[model samples]
Target: MTTASWLAIAMATIVSAALAQEGQTQSEEIEELEEIVVSASRIELKASEVGSAVTVITAEEIERRGDRYVSDILRDVPGLAVNRTGSFGAFTQIRIRGAEANQTLVVIDGVEVNNPAAGSEFDFGSLLVDNIERIEVLRGSQSALWGSDAIGGVINIITKKGQKGFRGFASASAGSFATHDLNAGFSGGGERYRFAFDASRFSTNGISHADEDDGNPENDGHTISQGNVSFGVTPIENLDIDFTGRYTRSFLETDGSIFNVSSLTDLDNDATVYQRYGRANVAYDLFGGAWSHRASVAVSDVDSKNRSNNATSFTSEGDKLKLDYETTYRFETESIPDAEHAATLLLEHEKDTIQTSSMANEVDIKTNSIAGEYNLSLFDDLHLSLSGRFDDSDNFEDEMTYRVTAAYNLRETGTRFHSSYGTGVKNPSLTELFGFTGTFVGNPDLEPEKSKSWDFGVEQGFFEDRLVVDLTYFNSRVTNLITGSGNTAVNLSGTSPAQGIEVSADAEVLDNLNLIASYTYTNAETADGTEQVRRPRHIASLNVNYRFLEDRANVNLGIDYNGDQKDTRFSPTFARSIVGLDSYTLVNVNATYDIHENVQLFARGENLLNEDYEEVFGYGTPGVSGFAGVRVDF
Candidate 1:
């Protein structure tokens, strides 16, 4: 079937369901409007009170879907696109609202994880779902709250913390491609102290990175091991201390590239990556919890090595250190009766360093910033937020960014109107500013990229909130986009504009069944009016969840559709040219059954339709695959 036909059918199903249950209400509870969002603002705010486009994926939903990788879960998010170059452990990139991959900032437990040596982009390839409690995605320009590299948005991943009592879990799974996964975690806590630890190991004899149909039959394999620890202690009544640390190591077999061509048939090519992250935080409250102070220090280090013919060919190391201090005060005044106000001030400093075998000298960059935010709530129905930041960099000119947002709720009509306007700035990455491999020379004179974005959306709830739908329109214009000219990097004089519409719906169709659907229409182009490569014009997804057998058994079905898009293909015999990639659909299903109070069994099937497709031009994708696992809790 055609892409249009699939989209039409999906839309028809959603519309028909809504109409059929127009006046009917379910007894089961729907998602609460009071859900708190921590990433949207300096202070935690309810989802209904935040003006930004936000999506939250909870651990419960992750378990139901049985997704081992975080990237798989993000594919269903609105206004986002995920592309993987090859098998599970290959390079993965995520673009938000047609923005570049490096434009999005990723934060894990308040620590920035984007690699400074690799264009400041966070690769999602090795990010597993272990120990993650929730993920909050805040869309649009967020430079006012975060610093540089947030032009597209921010993704905050919060891991599980210790609970009141002792708890632990263990799981094991074996699947197709000779894959195996093992995970275990434990947490324990009391009133004044808490701690948690988790570990995981995964391995797979994967498919060929290069398309096997091209006479490349060699299989590539990958393996990863990761560990995490979180600890917190309250030494006094008003003071708290917390610490978190994580380490990951991964090895991946890969196909080599010949000149401009990628994914060539090769036998001895592989890459190894090591990552370490640590953070320490202190918090204090005064004046009966109305005034708060926080101080934190974080560090991130990454080392990568690539080998050819069993010999090390290239290596790079990047490190970042950050320090932050913040204070917030909350008050209510008689001048504005029944209104609440919060003001926050923050000071931050960051240093980045990179060393590569190809560079003669180690490079370093430093930045200092001060930011402030003001939040207002009126009559429990209206919310407003304003924020601004000033950043001073040693290698670039000073920059100022600001954002304004408003959200109004109509209780009688069960409707909400929200809007935001923001300006963002992104400094050039280390590699873009310094030469690499003696081939791509850096441009020290490159200016920072700047952008202005705005979005408006309305959300409507029906049948006592059993069904909810949201529609949003967003537009952004970016200037000073850096591009490669000959062997040196240069900033473009023209502006690139991206505009899109996002639609999403959630409904409780039956007592034990729920449905979620989303569709996006994006028009993203370069300065010369060419479509952005790898960004599909249309994307849609549908997921259905059901519980049965006294709520002891659960099943989930998901469908994803990616519309045709353009991609750049490099060939040894021909010049690099734009090529069209065919559209494709994927179907996945998973089921879980609780046989005992502390034990459960689960199974998952991916690519059930056995579709043949490629996310990146020459890279291969997995076909039909299945897995079964058993989990135990104590």
Candidate 2:
């Protein structure tokens, strides 16, 4: 027994003879394994008993999927890859798998909203899927309990707690070029305390390619406004307190074509930016059954002013401060149900200030960590784990990362087996130090990108688990992947080879239908072999939802596929591929209606295959869209 334990004993003897001939029953294509998560092993279990690879989006699936930011509800995640270059507060990137969208990691209730002033990155348009209630996506490398950007995984944005009685909601939307949107929120509680508030506004108009809407066509569009407030208190229930605040004011303007002579006659720069964000949390339950504790603090203020009607000008104003504290412990003395033990102690501090006409980059960072994890489910379904992390940073210094995961549970024939091994590191973003302006130039000796990853998977649940099937094979090498060099000024950290393969399927097969399919195949290369710029190497997605009338009306459908990338540049003055971005497929539709007992009505349609794609080549995304809304609960 060695060959992965004889392929896990021949896949647990063909899943225990297919679960003794499908014991659970009913099968159209099984699918119903939805509650179990311990934040990747802070200990909770049940995203199929977690080996790793999890995705959960709830809140009634964000109200039947009519998105309002959060990168348009992640376009139905699966090895995600979202790139919305402009429209809705401009500049967006949510790369995963092939990594590099600031190395994925965004937490909300647990604090850490990235962006330590100059691209620590966390901009899913500053999140707001209407006071979200649940969203947990932990694909891999949770840095052994979340530390140092969780390296290509971890997206926990949980909000909305306080529903034992009072509630409220509102929504509005419009379509076509002059898109418009409005959102509203309310939450409540008693017995101790509870509160929530939300607000939003969005608008877009810029894309008139046929006749070229030029009067000022630097791409013509954008305006966004947002507000949020959340507060909760138990004061004593073993102590619990929370606070969240958000404000975003965007009036972004863009059209910098100093001279490409085609993007609407080389329009000159037009830019303005402003943002403010805040967070706070406290929870303590030590001495209780499963010891626990938490403390968090965060802040971000960015005001950017850039103008160039002719005389070139760019102003910079910044601020970011974060402090986080963590403590968690799970128990079982006289234990051994397959034993369980977990611990996490972390401390983090960061600061950044950048004032630049051309350089005023500053940084101060601090990190302290302690990680210990142990699990043994050996015979009940087999599970083994190990974890490690130690980091210290002031711009970069002490570092260490380690991980291992194992899981097996052929539960006599329903299948489940997983594997993982990891390591990752990345630091270096104050705009890579001086905020590389205009023609791209800034590299204060940049360097900070490291990696090593591995994953092997197999999951099948033909019926009992409800038609779930997943297959994964991943690999990574990465090593100083940042690149820059307009012309010999130095700093072009290369070397990469991030391989990938992830396939997914989730079927509920009739009971009001629900099917989700996924696929991702990447091969980001670059160490002298090029082909990794603007990243993209095939990503596919399909989602279907059904529930009509009796379920109070519901319907959702989706499809997205993107492939075709390469826009390298060493500087032929600013290369532009042979003009990449060719593969395109988009179609989206959503519907909801409950009509009473609180009020509900919804409609959404996007792209509907109005086919026109360009995640970033000549920039223009957002076509054939429509929206209608009505929501209220109290």
Winning model by TM-score: 1
Model 1 alpha-carbon drift over 4 Å, by segment: 1-33, 259-263, 573-575
- lDDT of residue 440 for candidate 2: 53
CA displacement after TM-score superposition, residue 30 of candidate 1 (Å) = 6.1
lDDT of 1 by residue, 248-303 (tens): 99999999667655446656799999999999999999999899999999999999
The Cα RMSD in angstroms, rounded to one decimal, for candidate 1 relative to the true structure is 1.8
Per-candidate total of colliding backbone pairs? 0, 7
Worst 10 residues of 1 by lDDT: 23-32
- Cα-based TM-score, every candidate: 0.97, 0.32
Which prediction has the highest lDDT against the true structure? 1
Prediction 1 global C-alpha lDDT: 0.90
Q: Model 1 clash tally?
A: 0
Give one digit per residue, the lDDT tens place, for model 2 in 306-329.
776655487665666677666767
Q: What lDDT score belongs to each candidate, Candidate 1 first?
A: 0.90, 0.68
